[model samples]
Target: MSEQDLFADIRPYNDNEVAPAIQRLIADEEFIQAILHYRFPHMPGVIGSVAAPLLRFILKRKLAKLKSVQDVQRQVATFMNKMIETTSKEITFSGLELLDPKKSYLFLSNHRDIAMDPALVNWCLHQKGFATVRIAIGDNLLRKPCATELMKLNKSFIVKRGAKGPREMLKNFSQLSAYIKHSLDENHSVWIAQKEGRAKDGNDVTDPAILKMFYMQGKKQGTDFATYMAELNIVPVCLSYEYDPCDTDKIKELWQKKTVGHYQKSEFEDIDTIIKGIVGFKGRIHVAFSAPVTSIPAEPDDLAKLIDQQIWQNYRLFPINYLAAGIQDSSIDEVAVEQWQNRLMAVPDGAHDLLTQLYAAPVAKKQ
Candidate 1:
């Protein structure tokens, strides 16, 4: 098969595919209902049922103008600007001066929030006149057809996570690795989380498996691991949120995992989490970009440690972190302590220690 045909199942939608995708999104009853529920969270069930068709009409009219991927991104950027202005107190970024605008990079970033981590990274790059990236989103999150449509429209490619057999798993990973290499070859940047999922417990460790997957295509080509990795121009990115919007939910989930040994999610839990992440309040935020890795390591484990060091060192620790770590000093005042205590009041007493450990992990890692 041709390269285009090989990657057709995993790649983002092209310009010619945008119109049909938008039309499908508009016609999808699930998508329309999701929008209605998100926009009018407190509306009665009867009212929501009545409003679905009207919501579809409004979406059709609004989305009619988005003729291409660039147009869709422009529309998203407008909403993103508004979201940042309203939900965040401040957003600071650094290390953009170290990057060349003409070069393509693989941005391997610490994952914290489901939607906001990449969205914020893309926003920072866009503001600095850099081309936006093709984000790697896992298939586990795309349980709905509408979800897949929305993600593809936003330039996200799927990472197949549901392979049922060892051969299928290898095939999926090989295709993903090839796609990443192909994107870089085409002078397009890409963003992928350091691991498969968000660091829900606030521990941002790079999984070596992720690095191995990244090298799959190169290994098949008989290239040295270090040489292939250096060719990708991998950049380690650090994203720090002073207050995670989904902290409480994350704390609960972690608590369950610790106490019950497993935590189960509802049918629409991921969707709900995505909505909460977007509309929820986040305090001061920081996105730190490190210079691309030059001293490439031969082993995935060593490379993971290197990436972890950069993320841990560059991570911005807030006053809340210190308080959660039980470090009382000049940096953390009585008011901060009181506020943190009040926040803890809403959490279950049994899970209080887990919450503390969540925020304290980064502080400990940095130290």
Candidate 2:
């Protein structure tokens, strides 16, 4: 099969495919109910059910003009602008001006919030007149059909997280590797988390397995590891949130895993986390774009360390971090101290220390 055909199952919706995907979303009853629940959370279930048709009608009309991927993104940008204005105190970026807008990059970002990390990165690129990236989302988050459609419409490609066997896992990883290289070759950038899931405990460590996955296609093509890595233009991105919206949830999960030895996630927990990440208040946010990797390390472990160093060094430390780490710096004001204390009080006593350590992890890592 041709490369395009091979990646068809995983690639984002192209221009011609956008309309059909939008239609599918509009026609989906569950998608309409989700919108109603989000927009009118206090409404009775019966009332929401009754209003679903009207919601669908409104969506169909509002989305009818979105005939291409760019059109969908422009609509998403409007929502993003509103989200940033309301949810965040301020959003800032550094090192973006140094990069060439014409070149494509593989942005290896430290994941915190499930949705906001990539959304903020795309927003930064969009505001700076750079083309937004093709986001790499795991299939675990795409269990809902509505989600899959919405994500693909927003230029997100799937990463097969549910490969059943070793052979299937290898096949999926190889295809994913090929897809990233393919995207860069087509002058389209890609954004992927450094690890498999969000670093709920505030650590931003790059997994060497991810780096090795990037090398799979290179290995198949007989390209040396260093050369292939350099060719991919991998850039490390750091996303720092002053107050993580889902901090309490993360702390509870950590506490459970430590005390209970295991924690189970509900069926829709990821979806709930994504919603919370979007609408919840994030005090201040910063995105740091590091210089693309020029001198590539031959080993995945070494490359992981290099990426980790860039993320840690360039991370925009906030007052909350200092407060959590018990570092009495000038940046930690009375207000920040109160906020940190309030957050601690909000969680259970047993998890309070975990919450402190969660916010303090970055401070510790940097030191």
In order of appearance, the predictions have TM-scores of 0.97, 0.98
Worst 10 residues of 2 by lDDT: 45-54
TM-score for candidate 1, residues paired by index:
0.97
Q: Pick the candidate with the highest lDDT.
A: 2
User: What stretches of model 2 exceed 4 Å from their correct place?
Assistant: none
- Model 1, residue 171: distance off in Å is 0.5
lDDT agreement with native, every candidate: 0.91, 0.93
Instruction: Give the per-residue lDDT of model 2 (tens digit) for 268-349.
Output: 8999999999999999999999999998888999999999999998878899999888888888888898999889998889
Minimum summed lDDT over a 10-residue window in model 1 is located at 328-337
Q: After superposition, how far is residue 216 of candidate 2 from its true place, in Å?
A: 0.4
> lDDT by residue for model 1 over 219-336, one digit each (tens)?
9999999999999999999999888888899988988898899999999999899988998888789999999999998899999999999989998988889989988667787766
